[model samples]
Target: MTPREQIGKQAEREYILHGKRGVTPKNLAHKMGVKLSALSQLFPTREDLILEVYRINVQEMNREREEALDRALVDSGGKPLSIESIMDARILPLARRCIEPHKGVQYQVGLSRFFTESSSIKNRILHEQFADLTQRFIDEIERALPYLPREEIRRRFQMTMAAMLGVCGILDMAAYGKEPARSEQEMWKMVHDLRDFLCEGFSAPVQDRHSPSSIHLNDGGRQWQVPLKDIACINADGDYSRVYYASGGCDMVRQTMKAWESIL
Candidate 1:
């Protein structure tokens, strides 16, 4: 490899492995097994290396997206890709890969701070690159009931996002607060129920002229169950009832999976 090219590769390795922002030509020289004086022939400044690493990440993310598209294409046997299905099949999984749990508190601190302070960028990136990931799910709700209006779809989307954000934010707060309010199981239940409730509201079909009544159990906080009839399925006012406490619509919302296992 040319000395210039080898220096470039070394700089990327530093950034990816160590998050080193101010990588000097000397640093790259050390990393690439070359003398500092020799390395300066091609590169000298830290920003040059920083800019290169940033461009590399963008390129890698695009390439990964392309590969995901290729796999989806093969899986579908030549079927056209829709933004929604591609998200479900690829983007969500990719996001999960970004979070790793290993022997450190820094990740928790960093991720929590990002969500709290930079949520707009975070949301925009997710929305734009994920091809309306959350929106695609919301669109599913509208498709489930063809007669639903666009405004209602938008409302349900907002409610779902609010509920998701609430779950993500509150659980982290609980982790670091003065006292943990509930065990992991209980916390999961709350989030699950919150999501289920939102989805049920979105997917409400034409109410049976006589929607059969079922038992209502606060479930002793074990499993919050309100019969299928009670969720904020359709609103005359066109607002999603996820935040509306009166609907008792826990059936459609997902409760924590752990709770069900314990109950069984």
Candidate 2:
């Protein structure tokens, strides 16, 4: 491999073995039998090296996911893709990777950490890639559940992604012996269980039980009921809260922010 690729690979290995914080320039250079100055010559900054590793791993993971999706499409034979199939295409690759030693899942965990804690430029680049991947999943959900509203589809997509990330996090801990690792069969079972749960959620009718359809507000002697969905946002104003609706109307209710938090 080229010097840059070698450094990137060594960096990834370090990250897998010791986590992101361990993949510093000195450690990587020592691991690769090179001087720190030489390594710095290839990557001017530590962030540059981290970003290279991130790009390599993320691109490979995305390629695998796309391949799985293509296989699913081929199997469908022009039929509409079922939620199960789409989910399998989306999730199974990551699940498989979670079992592989010192790779895949670890890389994902590191990428997530880097995105949250890295510089603004790095965060922006990662966000663009993440947003693109997210949109792809959202688009697949939209296709599977055409009857669902766009907003509902996006919400379900977010929930599904959150669950997937949760799984990754758990498996990552298990890899480090911080948590128990499941057998291959058990891991596959968990994957299917998650898929089944998400499918049910996506197929179910939208019933937002958390947010009341309308809330009653007593303003002076006049009492008015407003739809919670219509409210764009709520602002705190001393003891009272100002509620702004998407329709451009505002109301000051004799409710504290704490009360609005509970009611909303």
Q: How do all models score by TM-score?
A: 0.37, 0.70
Q: Where is model 2 poorest over a 10-residue stretch in terms of lDDT?
A: 169-178
The global Cα lDDT (0 to 1) of model 1 is 0.49
* Clash totals for all candidate models: 9, 0
User: Model 2 residue 123 lDDT?
Assistant: 70
lDDT of 2 by residue, 1-264 (tens): 988898998887776666667678887888778999999888877677667777776677777777776787788775568888878877877777775655545655664675455587467655855677767767777877889889888878878878986775565445556567666566667778888988888799988756788987866668888877888988889998898999998888887889877766
Q: Candidate 2 lDDT (Cα, whole model)?
A: 0.75
Model 2: runs farther than 4 Å from truth? 35-37, 101-116, 119-122, 172-181, 208-264
lDDT string, candidate 1, 73-100, tens digits: 6876755554344433433332322322
Where model 1 places Cα greater than 4 Å from the true spot, the runs are 1-111, 115-127, 173-181, 203-264
